[model samples]
Target: MISTRLQDAINEQINKEFFSAYLYLSMGQYFESKFLRGIAHWFYVQYKEELKHAEKFISFLNEKGGRVILNGIPAPKVEWNGALDAFNEAYNHEKFITSSIEDIMKIAVEENDFSTQNLLNWFLDEQVEEEAQTLEIVKKLELVGEHGQALYMLDRELAQRQG
Candidate 1:
């Protein structure tokens, strides 16, 4: 957050990260209502991770001598009729997040902020992993289709996700 432009970008990202947490929490509730404990557990972990991400940005901004401006996060929708629907939503969300990281990268490059660019490089790689994981979950849900036993088994697999 060396420049005002970068500061604005960081603030916007912080807001997005908070929204991500809320979004995952919504998905957690959706999974619970569907009796998908493993999926719910996964979303819970995701929510925690997003919060951690937000704090990381917040701390970085402060350390860089930028003022942290907190913004209100919109409430996320809490309904997904099936695992497929929920995962499709997650996939789209990851796409949106990837774009956000790309935009930050662009800003870092445009401002010639080598330190910021170095930091953004991490996000660039992280977005790839994020999209891949979400897409994998979507594909798994698609393959599981209407098979309740398979879905449950998959949920159990997801429940083991840590950090």
Candidate 2:
């Protein structure tokens, strides 16, 4: 059985994942309002993917016979300064998530929960990709530096992203 502390943390992580989805969807709406359809579409896809991640954690908990006590998600920021700002926020959030995953791994180590640790291995690898993606976008945005046409082009490129 998973420790209550560990289960609670994991449950909280699940909520955060859902919150991420909500946040991205909100960003998508904002982008659409700005008439940046490509960016909006990219965020919409990202939102769906984040929801999938939340569900994955939920299912993993269920498979482990742990109760998923969902908690409330905090409100996400509504206003972004611009496309670059929004993506920078996303990149920062991804970093936070990466650290959280690392902390969970530390807890697993302390508990000697080999099974839990093994399961988290997948997340560790996934986090690498997550960080890479967000960082890439941030770098590209930085390079473009307030260039609308370039931003639009990047959006077009991102819109091609598929699961």
Candidate 3:
């Protein structure tokens, strides 16, 4: 059985995961509006992955006999100065997520909940990869510096993302 404090924290994280999905979806739409199809596709893939992450938490909660309570997802910002601006936001968002996972891990450790700690460990590792990928894109965008051809090339590269 899950402790009340842990259960509440997990439920909150579930809501956060859903909000992350929504944010990525909004970024996808923004890219589409700018006619950056490949970038849009990349954000769409991220959106789906976020949904899967939320489902993982939901399933874990159920398995632990905890209540699943979802909250409303606030609207995400739909505009950016350009591709660099958007990818920078993405990178920042990943950092925020990493911090959130760390907070949860702290809670699990304090409560001596090894099961929850094990589950969060996966997310902690994932957050590292997530931040790295987004930051790489951000760095490339910075180097390209508003160059139309370079941006197009980057878009094509991002299009290769699968699942």
lDDT for each candidate structure: 0.87, 0.86, 0.93
Q: List runs of model 3 lying over 4 Å from the truth.
A: none
Q: Give the CA lDDT, 0 to 100, for residue 140 in model 1.
A: 78
Instruction: State the lDDT of candidate 1 residue by residue for 1-163, as single tens digits.
Output: 3899998998999899999999999999888888888999999998998898889888888988999999899989988768888888888988998799789889889989888788778777887888898899888777767366888788899999987
lDDT of 2: 0.86
Which lDDT tens digits does candidate 3 get at residues 1-163? 9999899988998998999999999999999998889999999999999999999999999999999998899999999998889899999998988888899889899999999999999999999999999999999888887567998899899999998
Write model 2 residue lDDT over 105-136, tens digit each, in one string: 88889999888798788888887887798888
Best by lDDT: 3
Better of 2 and 3 by lDDT: 3
Better of 1 and 2 by lDDT: 1
List TM-scores for all candidates, in order: 0.95, 0.94, 0.98
Candidate 1 global CA lDDT score: 0.87
